[model samples]
Target chain A: MAEIVSLADAVAELVRDGDVVALEGFTHLIPVAAGHEIIRQRRRDLTLVRMTPDIVYDQLIGAGCARKLIFSWGGNPGVGSLHRFRDAVQNGWPEPLEIEEHSHAGMANRYVAGASGLPFAVLRGYTGTDLASVTSTIKQITCPFTGERLAAVPAINADVSIIHAQRADRAGNVQLWGLVGVQKEAVLAAKRSLVTVEEVVDELEPVDGGIVLPSWAVTRVAEVPGGAHPSYAQGYSERDNGYYAEWDPISRDRAEFEKWLERTRTTGVPA
Target chain B: MSTATTELTYTSDEMMSIAAARALSAGQRCFVGIGLPSTAANVARRSHAPDLVLIYESGALGAKPDRLPASIGDGILAETADAVVSVPEVFNYWLQPGRIDVGFLGAAQLDKFGNINTTVIGDDYANPVVRLPGAGGAPEIAASCHEVYVIVRQSKRSFVDRVDFVTSFGHGRGNGDRARLGLPGAGPTLVITDLGVYRPDEHTSELTLTALHPGVTVEQVREATGWQLRVADELARTPAPTSDELAVLRALKEAS
Candidate 1:
């Protein structure tokens, strides 16, 4: 039987300094509450890894928690500003960082292959493109049968994996119908696992007659209904599309983050 | 409709022209990209492709985005989307299975053969400058889509004799070679720019302008290109953008 932890307590316990943590949700599907807790806790010198990046990474970088970030796409949603990330990439930041960009499959298959304990996963996605060299951590191989050359990407490993889900049972069976890529991989890759969920069901209540992610992989579950607000999970209200419509007020410039930290609520503004 | 006009009426030709060129068929499954391609795609979705299956590289399928996304990582693409699958399943299942009818793109650099370079702006790989977006699924979409459409602003700097690097895959080594690579389907079928609509000649891979936008001339188009430009004998006039089309597109941008 796993003990239920509060959202803040669960996150603070999982994340540590100098650890690589992968967050769940693509772009903005899931909220960045878990990482936000660490930022509030003022954890420093953290290395981050992701397949694709968005505003949350910018927030993490802005909060001065992230030492390095690894991912493919990096930019503010539409506001065209992310002061935290800009400081690290365009300007120099306190931490040393390296960026590994590749196609979605090139990054993902590598994790799948890694979790399976394979040396490298073959993919035809990155041939002749700069992704092969930029993410040189990924290699190329020749098909013994077809004589075709393909991409061989290495697996991703992290110290802790923090993910937010639409719903979870007390047993930690997870459910997320939309954009749950590598959630399992991030869980398997991390040594310590933590989950942020909307609500806790009694037991085995089928979302669509099935489970999205199971209990064995889930170590911690924190129930926070309406927590993923502003970041829609479908069937929940529509995303706080307006929040992103305007450039995140916090990410406008270098000093903007000072305002960002003040405005954003850790437990979501006492709602 | 009053003739007095309004402040919102854009007098400049550039914004209107960009708007008109991006109008696409509604309800198409577009394998969308970032930057100009994303702009054009969102415009298309707002203007005409309302039911468009806007597939972002992040694996959001049929995304009903309320605003124009600045990048692929916008939550609007996923949270508001109809369905979101794993990174692998989105590409391997939806895209490679031929659900994507059109792949929309733009380029930093191009050659006569239609190859694109979004990787670097300099000459060498190991030590060149201007490391670009580094190809995020553009290659697969370019190689496998039933048809690919490109929208780029014509400029000498962009239309190069040879690409500085390969970002999105197209016309792999010229006519018929992409087919040889078992790339699954026809390569880039259309290159749409502010100047005109260009297609790679069936025999030679040279880009030949077929339709020039109204008020655009062959010389003006050439001035914009980096390569020695060519035009078809019968250059068709691109249709002008209607007021309604411009209205929807501008509103869409405002929302984004």
Candidate 2:
């Protein structure tokens, strides 16, 4: 059974130091509130996983919460560079961050493998490319039937997987629509999972393209409206484009990033 | 209407966009990336390719976003999409299995053979002067889509002899390299640039200038290319965007 808790409590209870945590959302439902809570609680040494690490991951990396980033793409989307991410890699400002890069296909397959309880997943990728040499996780395997060479990557089983969705019923049945991404796979792959949603309703009315995770699959549920602000919830909000544009300058300098983080610390959310 | 040769109100960017958009036909399944590529695909969708099956990296299938989405994950895409599935399903079922007809993208750097680089700016990977948003689904989309169309602003710097990194395999080293590597799709078929349109030479796999955009000279194209620019024996002047194309593109921007 899943326990209904506050965002702070969920973060405090599930996330720990040196744990592999995945906050899975493609571009929508990014779980910004949960990331802020992790920063507020001062968790450290987390190996953060996501396909595209946007502003929330930037905030986590800026706050010195992440020791490593396992991702395919990291950017500010339409904006330029992630200065803090560059700082950690170049100067080791707060701490030296390690990167385990993979293609989006490889990362998605890793989650799929994890969800399926398989050791690894096979795909036709990284052929005549350089990713295989750089990423240690990527290996080569042959098909038994056709003797075709394929790329294989180990499963990504995390300690805790967190996601922000549109809504959930009181019984902890989470429902998310729009751009679903790998939230379901990440939840099924993780040993423990937390879902923060915009609302807790009495009934889980079906959405057109919704995926409902049964209460048994989730560990905790927290009601955090506007949880995916800066990103977005399908029915609840629009992507805060202004914030993304505003974040470029804030995340450019170490001092600016710190100032922003301090401000967030004071308010308990990014303005 | 004052017949002053249809005043050139649109910039070269819009010209390139319209040129790229025209390449896509109705009902083609397009695997689109963000930025200029998305803009081109949407322009096509609004203008002629109304039934274009727009598949985004975020797993929005048949997305008919009325407005331009800020990102691939923008809720507008999902809201307008016919269906949304998990990320794994997107790559596994739609993209990897080669179901898509066209792969649309933009590149930070491109080589003569049509190989693209979107990873880094400098030679050194460890300490790059500029680190770009690494490959999301480009590697697979390039590999599996039936054909690819690249839209980029042409310059000596962007059109290089060799890309700093190979983010997506094109013709590899040209000739039979792609086939030898077992890449399913025909690598980049067309590269639409601010200067002109380039198509791969069937024999050499090198991008050759087949058509020049309005008011753009072959000399300008040659000057912008890093390598020896190849021009077709009888180059075709790419017709300027029809008023209808411009009208639709302008309306799209205004509506979005």
Candidate 3:
């Protein structure tokens, strides 16, 4: 059964040093508050995983919390390059960071395989690309039925998976709508899961195109309103595009990023 | 061709976007990347290709946003979509099965053969000069979509003879490369840039400059390209963007 807890408690209880953690949200509902909490707690050596490692991951990476990153794309969405991520990879400013990259299809399928309790997943990807050369996780396999050659990727079973949702019932049944990207799979694929919701409701009135994660599937739920700030929860608020654009300059310089980090550290729950 | 009659003033970027939009036909299912590709796809839908289906990797299918989306998973995409699916389903069931008609992409760097490198700029992978966002859906989008179209600014920096890394394979060494690699899609049939338009040579599989955008000269295109570019025997001038296209494109930008 899922436990209703505070964001700090959830991070302390679920995330640990050197753990493979996934905070999965595509371009919407990113668990920014939870990422902030993890940073505030000073957790280190985490293998952070996500499809698109946007500003949240950039913050975590810049704060020197991550030891490795497994992701497809790492950018500031509409704005530009993720300066902190670029710094880590190019110069190793905070610390020497390692990266294991994959295409979106491969990463998504890896989560699917992990959720399905499978060893690997197959797809028609990376055939002529150099991604196969760089990443060892991508391999070639022959189909048993058709004798066709295909690419195979190992399942990504994270130690802990975190996500932000629109709402959750008191019993901790989480519901998310609008661009529900890989949150369900990421939760199911992890040994433990944490969901930060905009509110804890008496009941989740069925939302159109909403995905519900049953209490039993999820480990914990924390009510942190506006948890996905900067990145938004569909019905709750709008994506702060200006903030994303503003982040470029702050993150560009090392001293400015450090100051922002300090401010984030000093701030409370909804950092 | 005479440039006497057209009086409207527009940036080369606008012309590039309009030309890229013109490539899409109505009813085509286009897998769109964010930024330049997304802008072009939305422009096409609003103008010439009304029924064009816009698919975002964030799992919004047939997304019809009134304003341009800042990101692939913008709430507008979901709210306006015909159906929203999980990320896995978007790639596995929709894209991997060859259901999408076209894949529109943007590149940080591209080679003469259309190979893309969105990974890194420097020679060393461990220590790169500039670290770019790695491949999102471009590899499979390049492989599985019935055809691929690339939109990137033409420059010596972006248009290289050889990409630092092949983030998405276009044509490896030229003819029969994709076939030999078991890639299914017809990779990068058209490439639109600020300078002009390029189409792959049927026999050589090398991208050849097929048309120039308005007043852009062939010499200018050559200078912008990193490689010794090839030109079509009967190189044509791309028709200037119509008033309707400009109105729609400007409206989209203004709304965004």
For lDDT, the strongest prediction is 3
Docking class of 3: high
- Least well predicted 10-residue stretch by lDDT in candidate 1 chain B: B7-16
Which of the numbered candidates is closest to the native, going by highest TM-score?
3
Candidates 1 onward: DockQ, in order? 0.40, 0.74, 0.90
Q: In candidate 3, how many Å is residue A96 off? A: 0.5
Per-residue C-alpha lDDT of model 2 across residues A1-271, encoded as one tens digit per residue? 8889999999999999999999998988999899999999899999999988888888899899999999999899877677788777777768888888889999999999999999999999977776776789999999999999899999999999999988989889999988889999999999999999999999999878788999999999999999988887878998888999999998888788889899888898577
In CAPRI terms, model 2 is classed as medium
Ranking by DockQ: 3, 2, 1
Q: Count the backbone clashes (under 3 Å) in each candidate.
A: 0, 0, 0
Query: Of 2 and 3, which scores higher on TM-score?
Result: 3
Ten-residue region with minimum lDDT total, candidate 1 chain A: A262-271
**Model 1 C-alpha lDDT per residue in residues B149-189, reported as the tens digit of each score:** 87777788888777887776677667776766667657677
Please provide TM-scores, in order, for all candidate models, with all chains considered together. Answer: 0.80, 0.97, 0.98
Chain B structural similarity as TM-score, candidate 3 = 0.98
Model 2 TM-score is 0.97
Residue-by-residue lDDT tens digits, candidate 1, A1-271? 3346898788777788888887766654455666667767788888787665666777777777877766654555544545556556544553434555666666677667656666667766755455566666768678999987666777777788777777787777777655566676677666777777777887655554223666777778788666565566555655665666544665666566666665554544511
Candidate 1's C-alpha runs over 4 A off are: A81-83, A115-117, A209-211, A225-230, A245-252, A258-271, B1-29, B34-84, B97-99, B108-112, B117-134, B155-164, B172-182, B242-256
In the predicted model 2, the residue pairs found to clash are: none
